[model samples]
Target: MTVPLSRPAIPVLEAGMPAPDFTLQATPDQNITLSELRGAPVVIAFYPADWSPVCGDELGLFNAALAELRRLGAQLIAISVDSAWSHTAYATQRKLHFPLLSDFEPKGEVARSYGVYRAKEGVCERALFVLDGNGIVRWAYVSPITVNPGVDGILGALEQMNNSTQQDTP
Candidate 1:
């Protein structure tokens, strides 16, 4: 009898790594491509599902921080293995200003690329990545599944990036 081999785990991408680009549906008629937003900093958030208590609060915190995030020149996008319709409803109900992308259909394909896919649970692990204007990841974090990882770290990372950019400007 042959024993089946389990696939090796894919480690999450870290700082100094180039972010993998992909286009995901934001709405039924609209698609958001990561590469298209290359000239500005980006905050990529991966959550397990839409409408879950923790996710709602996590995104709500981000929503409240939209002004600050934008002031730092970072466009925030939260992704999950939920359908576009589900995301639409959830965003509308939550009054979210940032885009919530659907990683459904192919089901967590983007999450897998980011190494945040929870294959056994059919969802995404809560993860965050801050990328510079050139699409190089500047900070990355993966929080436990049940914890509500707040925006403090995100704010710090954006602030650091903002300062670095200003210093680099001639």
Candidate 2:
């Protein structure tokens, strides 16, 4: 009998590490550079695809939580191996107000840099990275592909980051 091997477990980013910066297509016409958003909190949601059921639920939750995320000084961006065209269609269909970045072409390079790319599956493992204004990761979590990790964790991390940042300032 032949045995099939499971994919290697991908690692999640650790808190206090500087985030990896990348320029990615956010729409059919626009591109965004991660480092350009410095001086503001940024939340990166890396998922597998555009139209998958779990992805839809997760992205929609972020969409609904947009105001709360903004109030906490966090800007959310959804990244996937999906193409810019795919992201554009998916975002429009879901009325997602946030940018959906395409990790296509070089495909998963950014995700791999963050240690969230699944090589065997050719997709980004469902993961979250919340970075503070200084671009240091405040929190991160990688969930099962079938699960939605929820916004509470992200919000809590944002609060903690805010407290720490305030303490560091005059």
Candidate 3:
């Protein structure tokens, strides 16, 4: 018989909280601001680092999902504590078209604000936040650091939000 294992749960920021606005380095010369991407759904992926094996596969999966995500009027912006240069190299190697914002310098400050920082590991816990066009968080999830958490939950949130917006339209 296999014994069941359990891990401590990490809390995720609750849905309906106003996503704290932030501007972070996206490239050597460019910065991305959360508020600037309004008028479309935004998927914020807070992962641990740039080159971890799981992180690479997780982001690669999102890269593959970009078309579907865009069709729903959603943009994917991944945030990690890695520096801009590191992010650039990682994105190049991974062929990721989405912006990978750096939470470097202060290191995990944005992750802390979102309640996803893993101080012991000096990285952000695996977390996902789906914000509506107006910048209110619609759904959130915290996954084990070694887990990917996939894109189904995000796709569900985008579909639900899109449907609601349609219903609200005249």
Tens digits of lDDT, candidate 2, 49-84: 999999999999999999999998899998999999
Least accurate 10 contiguous residues by lDDT in model 1:
2-11
* Ranking of all predicted structures according to lDDT, beginning with the best and ending with the worst: 1, 3, 2
Which order, best to worst by TM-score? Answer: 1, 2, 3
Predict model 1's lDDT versus the native. 0.91
On the 0 to 100 scale, the lDDT of residue 114 in model 3 is 88
Cα-based lDDT at residue 64, candidate 1: 97
The residue pairs in collision within model 1 are: none
**CA deviation > 4 Å runs, candidate 2:** 1-10
**TM of each candidate vs. truth:** 0.94, 0.93, 0.92
Give the local distance difference test score of model 3: 0.91
Regions of candidate 3 where Cα sits further than 4 Å from its true position = 1-11
Tens-place lDDT digits, model 3, residues 1-170? 96543322344578999898999999999999999999899999999899999999899999999999999999999999999999999999999999999999798878888888877668888899999989999999988889999999999999999999999999
